[model samples]
Every structure is written in structure tokens, then in C-alpha cells.
Target: MFNYHTLYAELLSSLHGSPLEKWLPLLPEQINQGLCEQRFGDLADWRQVLQQLPEVSANKIELKDKIQIDGDSSDNTRAQIKNLLQALIPWRKGPFFIHGTHIDTEWRSDWKWDRVLPHLAPLENRTILDVGCGSGYHCWRMLGEGASRIIGIDPSPRFVVQFYAVKHFIQGGYHGVPPVDVLPIGIEAVPQNLQAFDTTFSMGVFYHRRAPMDHLRELKATLRQGGQLVLETLLIEGGLGEVLVPEGRYAKMNNVWFLPTADTMISWMRKCGFKNPRLVDSATTTLQEQRQTEWMTYHSLEQFLDPADHRKTIEGHPAPLRGVFVAEV
Candidate 1:
């Protein structure tokens, strides 16, 4: 099995020259600034003798409740896609990915590049909106995958600029890729008049909202009765079907709230007017098992932070969510 931690470092190392390079270079420099002190790089040679570091636990968020998702017995593709998304999860939280691959710098022949292609749903001929479109990786992927018109929305000015930078490198203009238009805005920015989208996908975003019901209602308000919404967020195992974040702030990372369970999510979706809302796919069977046993190439938000920032996890949530939700309006 590939050492997930090592593989992540290697993958990130290869992304050194991309947009993400800005943040990582400092990490190595700080370690070696005074004399040869810091110790982290190199594909092998993990021990060339360097400064010793304090002990740390990978666990960042406190589990108010254990995560549990209703696994689809037949969708093996879910696992594959989760592996693809696993590479991006670490970037969603603090100390974001400061390497290029997060925004599609080099090519990955076997993984995520074309993996989401098959699930594109021939959306090219239809209208689609991608919310919380950080770096616009998936937004760009949708265009190439066949989305006739695509709107990429995000509230991060930096992320928006970076997304455009990458898109410009590929398509030459930000005006509109003939049918693809990327807007740097929040989910609430989607006009109520544009009430229907053939499909909508929001990843790592739903949980940011503390009021799951309100979030669902807004999503439903944006979708036409027949439109489809695909949501992916954290879920606790066999726990509270509906979790209320009375004490937690939605604005945890950015200015957004955090939610709890997927069941809580599904309940909100149903309350929002979506019928036949289904948990068609998911990868984390048990949060504890996956966190403690998996020898996979990935990490949680905590792995990417320094001690000062690491202690802040006590105020947040950590439920494994690296998949999709297929819902109909």
C-alpha cells in the first residue's frame, strides 16, 4: 500500500511550480532559513538528519457525533471517485493547497482528470452551476466534459483570480468559453430567475452552513422542479439524522457555517421540496475506521496546519465526506 502521507508530499512536491507554489516554498525556506534545520522534502531520503519536531495527532476536528453514510452497495465507482476527490479535500480547509495540481497544473493520466467525465451527465447541452468552485478545477472539467453552459461561482477573491488565471492559460478568456462562464460569487448569487439548472454540484460547501435546512431551501429555491442537485458533505455514522449546530459558527474556515450529518442533509433536502432525494454514493463507511486504518493517499484539514492553527479544531467538526448526493427537484 502506498504511504498516504508520503504520497501526498510527493504529489505536492511535483506541483511545486504551479499556482500553489506560493505557499509551500516558504515552508521549506523557514525550516532552512537560519542553518539546516527544517526536515521535510525529498522523494526518499526521509532522514538526512534535520530538526526534531513536536508530536502531533492527525485528528483535528472533535467528533460531536460519529459519521455514518448509507453506502450504495452497487456503486463501486463511488470509491474510485472518492479517491479522486480525496486529493482535493485537504485544500478545502486551512493552509490550502499551495501547489499546482489542485488547480490542474500537471496531468494525471489515471485518476481524476477524466474520472468525473463519465458522470458529466451530458450536461454540455444543459445549464449547470458549480457552487464553491474553488480553483475552478471541476468547473473547467465540466466544460471539457460537455457542459454547454457552465457557471463557476466562489466567494474567494484569491481563489477566483487563480481560477481565472488557470482558465486563461487554457481557454484564453474569462468572458465566456463560448458556453462556459465562470463567475466569482457566492451560491446566493445565483439569480432566483435562473431557477432551474440541469445539474448542480457543490462539494465541501454544504457542511459550511450550520443551518442545514436553510441551506437546502436556498438550493431548492435555485433549482427548477425538475432540475438535479448533486451535493457532497461530511456525515456522521448512524448518528443524529438531523444535527443542529446551535453553538457552532457556520463561518468556520471562510465566512461559512459547518453542518453535521448527511442524514441531517437529506432531511433538509426533503424539507426543501426535493423529491426522491437519494444518497446514491459515498466512500467513508466509518469515520474512525477510515481515519485510523486507511493507507491511502490523502489527509484531513488538520494535517495541513501548524500547531497554533491545529488547536482550533476543537471548535469545528470532522466527518469524512468525499462523495456525491443525487437529488431531484
Candidate 2:
């Protein structure tokens, strides 16, 4: 909806209008005088509040045409994403895997922030905490976009490398945001005081935790007044369905987690003291010759959704996810 650069342009234009009438019109009105002078300084702070309003201007955004398609196979798709990530930031090595299996652009481009970021309120001057921030894709992107500070916590040591790799490789990758510090421990280990943040985002990380509630409490502990949590993860379809139990791993994919329906997951978020938790987008993976979500890696489209293959066993238990859930605290 509202383009950052475009809005900035409007402010610049307004400032340069006819000096006599323009100055007269720009002066604060009677009731607004105190707010403009005491609360917002000049126009910058006022502009900041205007931008963060919970309004959707648009879902589409324009990015410099840097994407090059090598082909749509799994290997080629991964390469394209790696290059895209590199182009977004700088990385000497490739982008290591995060928690999701749907890494490909089935829904949105890796560089595509407009579709999701608009739904998330800004954190420019606020503290942001990301949980299970595998490789810190969300964390790093938020940093580059303009969060005041970012703290990423993941269990894997390799996350440290992936967390910083993109910024190391891409030109103008960090944008105007502050640097991020990634921790290699679980959320439980984060210092309690630093837990309070202006906003927090956890993606592809929460479902894997053994104790979802404890971690949710920890997540809530980090939020200050009027704060929000933007969470994204794989989910099931039916409302309040059976809680699937994982007997063993996929053997190949390491960061797998049990899939919960949107209803149950949202219920958990509500229990953790989050208000008005809602699903922003929900979709399931079906057939696609081209690589699908980050979840469909081990199998192809037909194989993943084949109804005959559904089972309690490891090999036939469908793909990593049947649906997706995006919510908030």
C-alpha cells in the first residue's frame, strides 16, 4: 500500500511548496498544537506513527530485477534462492537450510517481503526477538529492513554462520537497519531482562520445541505494552484434529516437528496471553513439477499428497506440512 520511498517523497514535496501560504497551512491547528510540538517534535515522529498504523496499503512491492532463473528443478531452485539470498545480502557461502521444507517460491519470492512484511507492524525503534531462528532468515531480514535491535536464538551452531552469511554477501544487503546478534542457545537461555522487547517474531521454529507452552510464556515475557509477535509455521487443516506423534525422524530432514491445525495452534497462542491471534495466510502443498515449499524437499508433488500414502509410518506420513499458519501475540 504505502511505499516507504514514495511516502518519503511526499514529505519532501510538501516541505518545498510555496513558502508563505505553505508555512501558514503547515502550522499546527489549535487542538493539534500541543501534540505536534511536545509529543512529535517536528514532523518525523508524527510520520513514524503514521507509517506504523495497522493499515494494509498493498500486498505487492517492487524489487530491482535481479532474479535469474536457472531452471525449476529442486537443485536449480535451491541455487536460485541461494543466489537471491546472496543478492539480498552478502554471503561467502550459500544460505544454509532453515526449519521449513518450503524454501522455493511457491507462494512468495525469497526476496518478496511485501506479501508478509506489511501484515507485520514495524519495529524500527523497538527490540525484536526471534525464536528458533534457524540461520536467522527472518531475523536478518528484519535487521536489514530497520529494526532497532534483533536477537536471534537457535539451537544449532550453524545458525550463527547462516545468520550472518547473507549480510556478508549481498550488496546493500543490510539496508538501513541495525546489526543483529544471534545466540546459539535455545530461548530458555536468553537473559530474562532482555526478554522484554517491543516486538517478537518466531517462524518455523516453535512447533519443534518439546514444551510449546513454556516457550510461549518465554515469548510473552519478552513483549512490552502493545507489543506483537509474528509467528509462522507449518500447520494441519481440520479444526482440533489429532495431535500427530512422531515415532522417529525422517532420517534425512533433521528439523522436523509435529503439525498442529490452525485452531489448536491459535488456541495455544491465546493461552500464552496473546490477544487476537489470527492466521494471515494458509495453504497446503500439492503437485508441482517445479520445486514447492521448503517442506516438499524429500518428495515430489504427486508423492507428497498421494492419499494412498497417508499413514502413521515414517515414509508414508505425507510431507512435512499439510498447511501453514501465520499468527501473532
Candidate 3:
């Protein structure tokens, strides 16, 4: 009912005659697996809500400023759109504008984008891959920055649906843009040493892996020789050879496994065969950047921090300090 075959066909057409053509055979199987392996019991219900969304043509599509799909619609139509989106609650990584309604998400992903965009190589006409790209928010941003094509991968079925919801409106209104797709798969699902993308981004994902080195190596394999890698993850204040393995949870996130100092991260990147790894920016995540909103009515950064000392998490670990690093393959 989600029509993944159309998307898969589009992906194949986009990869034809490109260096990524090597992925042609394996992609279909992987996509089928991703669809068959969906664990979300509410997927059908979510798909129905998506189907209920009104077909309103966007008079203007603005991605450079914000993810806005603007057009004139009746108040009833706008309300319908808002209600449909509200059903898909806990929108984590966006502040998307549709018609006249604004769906403010949990994380101010634009802030993260601003911090990383300045330090990277030019994205104009480059093949790009975004690992752990939740809801394809940054993929839209990458497209706005003139990427030739963008492939985003995240295993979450809900996130994939959210991406396609946005994509549905964008593709219907805007035409002749480069290919942009989000696959429901993990980094491990990708073939090794594909060496296809001109630029690769792995943000907010490194610390979640138990074997950080293997994750780094996988990222390296996705890039072409000398391609740029944008690595952003949790960091602590320490010298080289220092990393934190949280006892239980860091900021209430159980999946977090490693929190490395900036120097240690650079060292690990070099060890993974990346070249000239350099720390570009390091900033502590703020409550304003990630907080509870109507669209995401869940516990957020404020609830995760220690009441006595805000600088530490509820578990007594240091608060979330994120670092952005750029390296070459």
C-alpha cells in the first residue's frame, strides 16, 4: 500500500549509468527485506492517515530557508492537514511548514545544519549519502544546497513514512529536481567499499554503536577516494585515548555506547584510515535546541539533565556536548 516499488524503480533509474550502478542488483533485495522486516504494528494505520492527507498543490517550495510547502488552502483543508500530521506524533527532527500549518519538531535540526554546513566541502552537484538521516530533514537541506543526488538511510519504518509524506507534497508540486530518497535500512546493510558518494555524513550516530571503529570503517567504505566525511557525535572534555562508556544511560538514551573526547575522535578517525581529520565545531546541546513541543510531546533535554547540576545528565554523566568533525577518505 506504501508503493515502495515506484520509489525503488526511481532509485534504479537514478543510479543507471552512474558509479552507484554497482548497487543496482543488491538494492532491490535490500529494499524488499526492509519492507518485509518492518516491525511497526501501526504502519497500516499510519499509511491510512497519510492517505487521508488532502492533495494541495504547493504554490512555492522553499528548502533553502525552511522546509516549507506553501499554497493557498481553505481553513478546513489546512485543519485536516494539521490533524493528519498530528496523528504521526513525536516528529523528532524537523520544523516543516505545510500549507499554512507549522509542524515544529523536537530537535532544531536546522541549528545542526548551520554548524556543519560551513565546515564542509562544497556540496554543489555532488553525490551525497546521509547515514541515520531521520525523516530526511537534512536530505532536503542537502538538495537545497545543490547536491546532484542524495541517498538517506535509516532503519526506522516510521521515519521512512514521515519522509515519504514530505516527499509526496514536494514531488507533486516541485519538478525537475535531483533524485532524493530515504531507504529503510541500516548502515550495515550497505555493501562494503561501495566508494560511490562524493560526500558522506554520519551525525548523531557514532556513540550509539558498540564497535565505533567498525562504524567508522563502514562510513569510509561509502565514500570515494578522498571524499569528505562529516562526523558529528557526543563528545567529552578530555585528552586523547580517553572515551566514556556510560554505566547505564547518557541523557536517558540507552543506545548510547561511547562518548569520546574530540581528540580521541580525531585519533579514531585517523586509525580508521581517514586523512587529515579535524574538529570543526563543538557545542553543548541546549534545551532550546531539543525540547518538548506539541508535535513531540515526550521527555526532552530538560528532563534528562540533573536537577542539582544542569551540566550533568540525570545519570550523573556529563551533559550532552556534541562535536562536528570533517575528514577525508
Candidate 4:
């Protein structure tokens, strides 16, 4: 019984009479459909857990150096906060400091942010969209960097709940911050040709698509003319025109369709009508960046790689090498 209607109305109110007002009429239905379809079996239980969180005011909210929520809370209350967050296991994209508790997620998503931040157009006062934003972690960082507003889309119900949990603290404590919201939807759910955002980010998502060109086109459609596109995905070392369509699972990740070389990825971007595609940063994902943590106890990148050859996955595909590219729509 999460009041999505109220949430939708709030979103509409925030956007009313703005440039994004065109989305108001259709957004409620789209969000409702997405919420219904993506409902997890344990969604009710998750919502209950969210309700169980102790009410505490975050007197100091920090997002510049790290995502931290600081306030005066007794140790017992801090323990309660920690236990409540632990229920949302498999936290995959953050290292959020809530009160006196630290929820260390599987991926050091901050590393990825650092890599992509330097090469992009300034986010200040821009309407930003984050495709496949897990738990809205990067969206918070985008807000920290001075974005006017940000909307993140992810299909995972757990992620949506986790985002709301964090947002609860922020909104309860720090009022008057710029608007940010995470929709329970996929990239495909985005209305085609909306063309509303100043910057659109598709990170760690392109390779997961069955049809990557279509994915690129979808990313393109979300941006206005001359807007920036930040693309980050897995890549392999090879010359131009070469790409790897994983024979099966790559690094134990199913549904990973393609990993193109840097040169080839630039070519694909150009073909999709993106201008001045430039390879910005490329790095191999390391255990330090993604590994099992107390909050995310599941097996991670270390377990997926080959013991015999670290350069290859356990399934013998090339190991995880990521590339970041920036292009213009």
C-alpha cells in the first residue's frame, strides 16, 4: 500500500507549468504500470521494513565528498537504523553513511563517478536523467554537483524502496534541496522522443540490452538537441570494427549481450547520430571497487573471474573492462 498516487501527484506539482509539464499527463500511468509490473513478491515486507525505520533528523547532510547523513541519535537508535537497513540486503551501488551506521554496498560506485565526472559537461542547473540508476546513488551525486533536477529510472522494486528510504531522511532533515526522483521503470518505459533532459546517462547498462543500437537510440531520444550523453559499459581490447557478443554469461552475468571495443563503440555512437563521440576513461573493474561486503554478502566480481587467468572470466570470456564515452545528441 505504498501511496504511488500521492507520489505521482507530488511529482506533477513539482513539474507543473515547467518545461517538463508535458510529461505530467502520461507519467502517472507509466509509473503505475511500471510499479505494478515490477512488484516483487516481498514488496509488502520491504515496505513494512521501511516503515520500521526509526525517525531521526539528519541535522547535517553531506553529499560532496560522500553520501552521509549525520545527526544526533542515541546508540540504541543508531543500532535500530542499522538493523532496518540490513533487511535490504544486497545493496549494490553505495557506501551511504546514515546516522552513525555505514551501509557499504557491493560496488564502490563512487569510483565510477570519479571516472565519469571529469569528462562531462557541468551538471549545474541541468535537468539530468540517469538510466539504470541503482538506488539513485548517482542521482544524489548529481544533485550535489548542482543539478536543477534529476530523474532516475530503474526497474528493480528493491532499488526504488531503498531510494525512498534514503530520500526520507534527506527530505525530513534538509528541506529546500533541488528536486530528485527515481521512477520504477526501465529505459524502454521512457516515452520516446521526450527530449527533455540537458544530460542523459546510461552507465553499466548498454551491454545488458539485447539490442544495443536500439538502446543507444532510446538514450538519444531522451536528450534535447546539443545535449550531452554519458555512456559507460563493458568493453574489450580490440581494434576498430571488433566486438564481443558473449557466447553465454560474461563474468557470471546473464543477459549481457555485447561488449564493443573503444573504437567500435565510437563508431556505433556516430551511427546512432551522436556527434563527437570521444572515449573518455577506460579501466578494468577491480575487487576494491566491487566485492562482497557486510551489507551485500553475495558473491561478486572476485568469484566470477577465472582463478587460472585473471584476465578471463570463470566462463573464459574476457574479464570485465569498462569504458566511459561522452557524445552529443
RMSD of each: 16.7, 16.4, 1.4, 1.5
User: Can you give the lDDT of residue 132 in candidate 4?
Assistant: 96
What lDDT does candidate 1 reach at residue 14?
40
TM-score of each: 0.54, 0.55, 0.97, 0.96
lDDT of each: 0.46, 0.48, 0.89, 0.88
Model 4: per-residue Cα lDDT over 136-162, one tens digit each: 899999988989889999998889888
Best by lDDT: 3
Query: At residue 56, what lDDT does model 4 achieve?
Result: 82
lDDT (Cα, tens digit) per residue for candidate 1, span 78-141? 3432343333322322111211112222212113323333454466466677787665656655
Q: Which runs in model 2 stand beyond 4 Å of their true positions?
A: 1-115, 169-178, 193-195, 250-257, 285-314, 322-329
Segments in model 3 whose C-alpha atoms lie over 4 Å from true places: none
Stretches > 4 Å off in candidate 4: 37-39
The collision pairs in model 4 are none
Model 1 weakest lDDT span, ten residues long: 48-57
Give the better candidate number (2 or 4) by lDDT. Answer: 4
Q: What does candidate 4 score on TM? A: 0.96
